[model samples]
Target: MRRSSVATSFLLVSALGLTACSGGGSDGDDGARKAAEGLATALAAAAAPADGASTPSDPLAAVTWTGTDPATVAKEYAAVIDGMDGIAPSVEVAEVDGEADKPTATLTWTWPVVAGGDPWTYDTTVALADGDGWAVAWAPSIVEPSLADGETLDATTLLAERGEITGAGGEKLVTERPVVRIGIDRTKVTAAAAPASARALAELVDIEGAPFVKAVKAAGDKAFVEAITYRANDVPAAVRTGIDGIAGARQVTGEQALAPTRDFAAPILGRVGPVTAEMVEKDPDAYRPGDVAGVSGLQARYDEQLRGTTGRSVHAVPADGGEERELFLAEPAAGKPLALTLDRRLQTLAERVLGGVTPASALVAIRPSDGSILAAANGSGTGGQNYATFGQFAPGSTFKSVTSLALLRAGLTPQTQVQCTPTVTVNGKRFKNYSDYPSSAIGTIPLEEAIAQSCNTALIGARAKVKDGDLADAAASLGLGIDHDLGFPAYFGEVPPPASETEGAADLIGQGKVLASPMAMATVIASVQAGTTVVPHLVDGVDVSVPSEAEPLSAAEARQLKAMLRRVVTNGSGRGLADLPGGPVIAKTGTAEYADGGTIRTHAWMIAAQGDLAVAVFVQTGESGSRTAGPLLEEFLRAAR
Candidate 1:
């Protein structure tokens, strides 16, 4: 019967009698069908839009009136609905029986018990005859999954513990550590002063004040406005003292699994916090409101493995002081540990060394034997840029190592005679060596001597020796300009085909269309020392495959290139590193030029190898590779020993 027909039948039935009766009447079948149809309509209305709107404000409003004592049922239904977090309820009417005026309606309730569908359905009958026309006889028992008499709907959440992140030696990289949460305690200060207080805190903490001010101004009058979270040891002693002196500012201390030092490999470790609304919408099955999970870095990349599966249980509580029945039980599992390939000592040291650089700078170290990343450090002056593995900058003269491979592939040896000049022009672009180019190495010299002295004009003078794609091929062979999946954000060097001879000349000195991360340059130096490809890796067992068609460098050719780089430290531009206390060393220097807001600046770069260790250092806006980057490399090598 139509919904209107059900209304008509209900009016006729109520006029006769809607209360429970002793026997069936002549129109019992029609009344039963109409009552069942009415039940279906009421339940379906709960899920339908209202008055041309997309969604109804109160989804269960229609069903509330269909039960006995509408006032009491409405409150109870709202309570149950409010408690359900990830439930989508649906209902259907199946059959009915008894007198036409006091018919019993059979109903089936279906809803997903778990996310992504593990539907649980139950069938029950409701008496539709009371004082009103076809009034519904409702109770908690007729709800989805058949709630027990006098029992209320509820939920119990079992949270899985967050995981830990470890380093190469299986030492703790991130673990439960003390932290400080700085915020404004509303009870101690008026909301009107929130903006001023935020500015004060910003000045004291060295963070942006505008966003904090806005957040504070928008918070409730009695809300505690949290500003930022920092590892306990990270908050400078002076800053913490200043905070303690503030009238309304306070610190909330807690412990969480995090890096021992807040800035130690921060870009790689990431963080965990309360789940965002946008994240929940994207993965509804994996999250809920108020849940916390990894948001970025390795924490987010391995969140699933780190945050183990959650266990759940359902209990049927009794109204009378009796025992509760266990309806469902699933034990929880703790999270697992994420292992990395970092060297804790080395990473810590690298951070300290770069901490003072005035311009953006980075240091990357790797062990070529197994392609493991030991350290990736970004200086405080970098403004939080992850240049160690992600920043793309011209590599400068350091790229000559790759060019040497190209030269080697073209039949030139270290002793081959090549002209080293003051300047040369290619494709209408004039190229010159550094202004202080040593006169002794500027004339006709051995090919190795040209590389050692880092002569731009000399390398540019030999551009005819390299064809289109040959430099790119040679770079790939040394693991410089290649394709890779390191399982993290990284920029392997890129060597696009030079569009002109000038571009080729630029390419010869690590300029033009070339770009590389500190990590990429480290791999180049490491691969040269190892005589093959060196693909950098961070996470253990997470194979970082580099897809390259370029042939690997031969042991013989690698030794030849190695010998040339050695000469750099012993007799040329890199001579400053000759007296390093560490074991014998091989090094190359580079200076890359780029335009910064209409002003010209150069990036200083150096790549070196000593024993099993290989390192790359970069300083954006530096004078020269040897002068700017040499000391940093020396410091690292000395400390590593």
Candidate 2:
């Protein structure tokens, strides 16, 4: 029962005098307060372990009971809260009251249900009599005011609704969707037939049979061991029929957080499932067995904000078949929605453009105006890798754009003439153009024409025009090497300063050691189109600061770069995208060579900017950027139009 502070104080003063007279101690007020405090300390010690120990101390050893056995009362008290997930209460002496022979101490019991939550608190009084010293008067009311002799407490968790993941314009991306949980219900079949049923169900669901059989054998007699979960409509008719015929197979329908399609932005959006053992071990307060949580991607990164707070309640159930009464309750709070800058329609279109690609590939698109990432799609050939924003590969001739910027900053203009030779050599290493380089375009030509034809020799020949770190500085202005928090997992391309002249020459054509993801290449074109440095972002409302060390891109440089790129689409390798549906497309195509397994392989790359959208397409194995990645870019531009 709750009493006002004034009344509690008055009761304590009256009880202190009574306790002094009843031989609590000879020192009157001080002695009585000390004795009462000692009793409170014992109650606290018995409530829980000291310093996070697993086992709680015995209450019988801490208290002396009168007219009742201490062991029996302690056992009864332990059983009252057996179902509370090992939660312990904080018991402290609130006040002392009553007469000379029967002084009472009110102990406040507060139970911790969840981390950082308001505790469940209530007051219960214990009688104290001087049998030898002060002995606790044993009764059911000492544990709780309303706790009867035969009632026990039970705790139940109330799960909160998971929040939705929204795209640009607040359209729901990951939300509640119907699903079928396929499993083996062991109770429906005899133990002898369970293994055969599990194997049959596994084969019908396309899972391995041996593992399913082992799992079925290990599960409890009444346990339901799940094999897999699929979208409700995705389960095949034949598989459903096979499950129904199996001895113990069952299907349960439910809703879970899911995207529009299984693969729609999967690597970025992630998925939710039962918490793993590692997750529970890492933060036992936040997760428990059978708890569903985000396991990967944005879902895992923002799990605390998206998973919401789980509510808990303790009910007092009567052993004599009476109605249960609530002792504590904490209402669950729904999770907050996470917003992203992705354009669902554009993202879906980009994925479709690469649907037929058989090599590891990626397509990334961005809005240069605001630096918002519109789409990041990976082809099936990527084998579940997030190559769109994290793949690090040689950018090939597309890096000519960064080299051009370095040369432009060093006083070389588009009109300046340079030789586009068939081959160039540095440090005894001969470098030649791709096999399909045009014979007519190979000769002394303007720098702009050299870029339009993607002349590797022309750029390498101009390596002396800029010193070391010049290429990296230029790449940084185009958002290649510099890292940003971005509020998500992303890999910025790397462009370290060359260690030697030969390496320097190779760096100019984006070869030696330069590496970039599709997102970084997309940002390069986006910067040129925006006329300023662009930092690509996926999650909404995250502050991505530009590095102070990076030289800011100027309008004049972007304007000249944009013109050279436009000429490529109109007259050079990117001519395939010249008739794209969108407005005039400024583009660059690249083919980089790398030795794989003692054989030569090439990475195809193409970057383009059309109207407000900038796009990059990359194929891990291809003939050439113009032939491989350019067509995908053109298809996406047309569809996105």
Top-scoring candidate (lDDT): 2
Question: Whole-model lDDT, candidate 1?
Answer: 0.76
In model 2, what lDDT does residue 228 have? 85
Residue ranges of candidate 2 with Cα displaced over 4 Å: 1-75, 97-103, 127-141, 180-229, 235-253, 320-322
lDDT of 2 by residue, 1-641 (tens): 01123323333333322221245534444444445655454444444434443323563554556777757767777777665655766566688753456567788877777656897889998776754456667666666789888888877777888999999898999999999989999889889999999999998899999977987997767578888889999988888887889999999899899999999988888899878778987887788655789999999999999999988888888988799999889988889999998999999998888889999999999999988999999999988888999999999999998899999999999989999899999998888888888899899999999999999999998888988788889999998998868888888899987888888888888899999999999999998888888899888778866777679888789889999999998989999987787478899999999999999999999999999999999999999999998889989888888
Residue 142's C-alpha lDDT in candidate 2?
69
Per-model C-alpha RMSD? 6.9, 6.0
Error of 2 at 632 (Å): 1.3
Among all windows of 10 consecutive residues in model 2, the one with the lowest summed lDDT is 1-10
Question: How does residue 551 of candidate 1 score in lDDT?
Answer: 85
Per residue, candidate 1 scores C-alpha lDDT tens digits across 1-641 of 00122333343233222233322254465655555555554443442224353433443333323535545665565444433343445556667774545567777765444443344456877766633333456666656445665665544456667778899789999877888888877667777776788889878887788977877786655456777778887777877789876657888897667887769898778887666668887886777654568888888888888877655555665657378666655555778998888999999988888878899899999998878899999988777768899989999999999999899888899998888988897867888888788898878999999999998887778888888888989888878777666778888979998787778789889999999999999999998888888889888777666565768778889899889999999998888889888677899999999999999989999999988899999999899999999899888988988
